[model samples]
Target chain A: MSALALFQVVSLFLMAVGFYGIAFRRSFVGMLICVELLLNGAGLGIVAAGQLTEANPVLAQLSTLLVMGLAAAEACLVLAIIIVVAKRWKSVDPSVVSELKG
Target chain B: MQTSALVLFVIHALIIGVGGIMAVASRSLVRALVGLIMTLFGVSGMYLLLNAPFIALMQLLIYVGAVVILIFFAIMLTKAPAGGEEERPNQVRTYLLALMAGVLPTFVIGWVVLTDQPASINAPLETGLKALGQGLMEPYFLAFELISVVLLVAMSAAVILAFKRRQSR
Candidate 1:
């Protein structure tokens, strides 16, 4: 396999692991960590594709920067939500805050 | 690929793999946060290997410096137990389902990647800080401005959401 393929495999591994974490984690913060991993995998994949394929490297890097910005924004919002949940519900467990479950 | 680069790639990938597993499997949220930091560091290293030193530095500054610290503060504020989360009963089926759901995409994409090669490999470009700045200020100016707006909105919303209020109960 080429070096690029190896990088792609690593990205895939990260994505899969992140998805599993998101699905398995019971707490909001844990899920948030997994989401960050997923985004990293996505960024890695984009950069790998741009570097290895016939795409514009500048655009790829730019897009990854945007993804990073989005991740930061998401982390900000989610952390705030987490704090609110902790204060009001007195726990970070998702199961404990299941009022919307039907 | 050169031997040195290959070795470095292996090291970075190992860091990411181990860190990601720890982040997911650890019971303690604090330990998991540490794992997340390790993974972020490894990802920045990969960015360096991909010829984007600026992005690598940014990843370190933004993720490790800013995001991780924010998470740490949140953890301290929430006061989650240091002993870690307790396991719920009867979760085998759920675990299996989640595993399958997660692995499916990797298998599908890996298969395609193995079977079909990319048409051509592009030479790496030296995207200096100047070029990146010009690109952001020119062709991608709209996206740049929008991202700033989005971040501002997010910051305001976070403050509003986390603000304390007098509750008459």
Candidate 2:
């Protein structure tokens, strides 16, 4: 495999692992961790594409920067939600924290 | 790719792959967090390989330094069970479903990447911090400004959510 393809594959691996974690892990925090992996995968793929392709490199890095910022913002909000959920529901499991379950 | 570079790339890829699996599959949340740190570190190495050192450093600072610490705080605050007592006898179906869901996308994307190879352009190596800064300041100024606004809003929202929870109790 070419270097670029290898990097892309690794990023895909990260994304797959993240999806599995999100679907299978019961804890909200674990899902959040997995989300991080997914975002990292996205950023890596973007950079790899820019690096190897004819795409504008600066724009690629810029996009990755935005992704990082968004990840940070998302992490902040999710962590806060987890705290609030823990306080109110007394459990961090998604099933236990459900109030709209029919 | 040179022989040395290929070796380095393989090492970093292994780190990311192993760390990703560990982060997802570990029983303990703390161990999962550790695995996530490893993955972040490996990604930064990838950024270095891709000739984006500034992004690599930022990845180290923002992801490994800040986000991981934030997660650690959350883990400490929640103090959930150390991955025990939540198992059910009928969870095999759910596990298989999740595995399929994850693997399907990987295979589809992998096939596309392998078959549709992007033509590599021998562009000048100007992916330095200076270029990044100029791009952010010039053409991407609106986006740069908007990102700060987004971050500010997110920070305030997080603070409000936490404080409101405290006041409710």
Candidate 3:
């Protein structure tokens, strides 16, 4: 495989590892860390696609920036929710968080 | 020619592998976050290898800088009973589930790499930065502005949620 292609494959692996952590991690914080992993994987994929396609480098950069902004916003909102949940329940385990569950 | 690519590929794979393992295996929540950040930095390095330095910088700024720090703050504010000794059920099952989740994507990616025709490596178009600016300001302007509004709303909501409740006694 080409160097670029190899890099993409590794990026995908990193993404899978992140998702695996998200799927199994019990704590909300752990899951959030996994989400970061997934987002990084996505950023790597976008950059790799941009390079391989030889498309507009600036567009790729800007789009990635947009993704980052969205991620930041998401982190803020989720952290708030997590804090509220922890305060109410005294734990951050997702398995026990059932306020919204029917 | 191919040898240099192979060497770089090896180094990239090593960085990603080590970082991924660290992210999954770390015991402390903060340690896990650190590992995740390392993985992101590794991915950004890969982006640099792919010739997208700008995107790499964005990865560092957004994922490592903002998101990870926010998580650390959340951990501190919530006072997560640290040391990672909480007993969670189904240890074996969780590992099995993680393995199952990883299988399909790996197979699909491998298949694509094996069967697909490779495209020639050309000089990337120079209009990327300019076109990106135009696209952001013109086509995606509304969405961009809306994102700002959403962030403001989120910030306000967070502040309100975190405010202390008054005692009735």
Candidate 4:
């Protein structure tokens, strides 16, 4: 495989790892960490795709920046919500914090 | 040249794999967060290898600086008893669903990679701060402003959600 292709493969592996964490993590904070991993994986994929496609480098970088910003905003919002839930339920375990579940 | 790239790929893959395992398997939330940070760092390295320095930097700034810190604060403020009842799969069906959720994306991505011939990597890194600024303020200017508004709304909402009950009490 080419260098770029190799990078892409590694990126995908990271993405998979992140997904696995997201699937299995029990705590909300742990899941949030996994989400960060997933977002990073996506960012890496975008960068690799941009490298492979020289046609629009600027666009790719801009999108990557946007993703980063979005991830930051998302983390802030989710963390705040998680804190609120923990405050009320006294637990971060999703299994137990099911008051809203139908 | 190819050999060096392959080595880097192997190293990055190992980092991601180990970090992923640590993040998922560890019992401590803080340790899991650390593992996640390591995994993100590996991804940023991969981005650098892909020749997008700006994106890599953003990865560092946003994921490492902002997101990870947010998680840390959550862990600190929340009173969740660490190392409580082991997180068991609540049901067989849920376990199966989770497994499917994890496997489906991997298959889709694998199919795309295997079927599509690897594209050539001839593009030199063209993203500099100037170009990024130009694009952010130009064609995507409206979207950029919109994102700022979205962020404002999200921040205020988060603050309100987190503190509303406290103030009421």
Candidate 5:
């Protein structure tokens, strides 16, 4: 396989790992960590495609930057919510904090 | 690929893989954060290998510096537990289910990628801070400005949410 393909495989594997973590982790913070991993994997795939494919180089860079912005915003908002949930429930376990379940 | 480039790729991949494992599997929250930082660093190095130095720098600065710190602070302030629960007795069944759920789509994607080789773009990245700046301002100005606004909104929302929650208690 070419180097680019190898990198693509690595990023895909990372995404899979992140998915596993999201499902397996018992705590909200751990799931948050997995979410970051998934985001990074997406960024990596974009960077690789930009570097390897015939598409505009700036396009990938721009999209990756946008993804970074999204990630930052997501992190801030989710962490805040996590804090609120912890405050109300006195725990970070998603299973325990599900108060509004139908 | 040049021998040196190949070596660097191997190194970066190893770093990323190991760091990813530590981040996902570690029981301690702080240790998981450390692993995530290592993974981000490796990703930046991959960006360097891709000839996007600016992206690499931004990745290091934004992800490693800002995001990591934010998560760390959240964990610290919340005093979240260090270790999560141990794998339950039905761990194998759950693992199989999760594996099946995660791997199916990935297999389809991998098949498509293997079958359809994307057209390769061999143009060297125009490597100049000025050019990138101009590109961002000229064609992507709307996105640039919008991201700033989005960030501001996110900051305000976080502050309001946290503050309101604290007050309500």
Candidate 6:
């Protein structure tokens, strides 16, 4: 297999790892970390596709940039939510957070 | 395909794989954060291998520098910085679930990746950078500006949410 394909596989694995983390992680922040992992896997996939394929490489780089920007915004908001949740619920575990259960 | 490049790629792959495993498998929040940093650095190295120095630098600066620091502070603020993170019930079942959830997609996607045809686009090296500049300056300009607005809104909303939560004490 080509190196590109291998890299793509690695990215796919990262996404899976992230998905698993999301599925099982008890804490909200752990889930958030998993989300970041998912995003990074996607960004890496885009970058790798651009590098390997003859398609518009700029598209990949630009998308990765956008992903990075979005990730920053997401981290900011999620951290704030974690702080609020921690204060209100006195626990960061998502399993314990059930105020939205309707 | 040089030997040196192959060696570097091997090093990077090990870093990414091990770090990712540790990030998810470890129970400690601090250890997980450390693993995440290691994974991101490996990712940045991959970006360098992909020939996008600018993106690599951005990954290092934004993810490694800003984002991780923010997470660390959040951990401290949330009272879970050092350890004592809660593990969910049915540890064996969760492990089984995680394995199933992770492995299935990897298998499916790996098959497709192995069978897919190669890409056929042929753009010059410098042109990619040029196109990015044009995109930012023209077609993508509005989106770029909107991103700033989104950041502003998110910042304000986060502050408000935290303030409201604080006030109800």
Please report, in order, the local distance difference test score of every candidate based on alpha carbons: 0.86, 0.87, 0.72, 0.75, 0.83, 0.82
Q: Which stretches of candidate 5 lie over 4 Å from their true place?
A: B84-90, B121-126, B166-169
Predicted complexes: DockQ each: 0.69, 0.71, 0.58, 0.62, 0.63, 0.61
lDDT of 4 by residue, A1-102 (tens): 555566566667667766776777678887887787777767776767776765577777777777788888898999888887777777777878886799
Better of 1 and 4 by TM-score: 1
lDDT (tens digit, per residue) of candidate 1 on A1-102: 776788888999999999998888888888888999999999998888877777887888899999999999999999999998898889888889999899
- Can you rank all candidates by DockQ, best first? 2, 1, 5, 4, 6, 3
Clashing pairs in 1: none
lDDT of 3 at B57: 73
Q: Which DockQ-derived CAPRI band holds candidate 3?
A: medium
Where is model 3 chain B poorest over a 10-residue stretch in terms of lDDT?
B120-129
Clashes of 6: 1
Question: What TM-score would each prediction reach against the true structure?
Answer: 0.93, 0.94, 0.84, 0.88, 0.92, 0.91
Q: Candidate 1 chain A: worst 10 consecutive residues by lDDT?
A: A49-58
- Residue pairs with clashing backbones, model 4: none
User: Would candidate 4 be rated incorrect, acceptable, medium or high by CAPRI criteria?
Assistant: medium
lDDT of 2 by residue, B111-147 (tens): 8888988765433254767888899999999999999
Kindly give the stretch of ten consecutive residues in candidate 2 chain A with the minimal lDDT sum: A1-10
Q: Is candidate 2 or candidate 6 better by TM-score?
A: 2
Error of 5 at A42 (Å): 0.9
Model 2 chain A TM-score equals 0.96
| lDDT of model 4, residue B140 | 90
lDDT at B87, model 2:
43
**Model 2 stretches with alpha carbons more than 4 Å out:** B84-90, B121-126, B165-169
* Of candidates 6 and 4, the better by DockQ: 4
Candidate 5, residues A1-102: lDDT per residue as tens digits?
Answer: 766687788788778878887887777778888899989999999988878877777878888999999999999998899888888888777778766898
Clashing pairs in 3: A56-B128, A58-B128, A58-B129
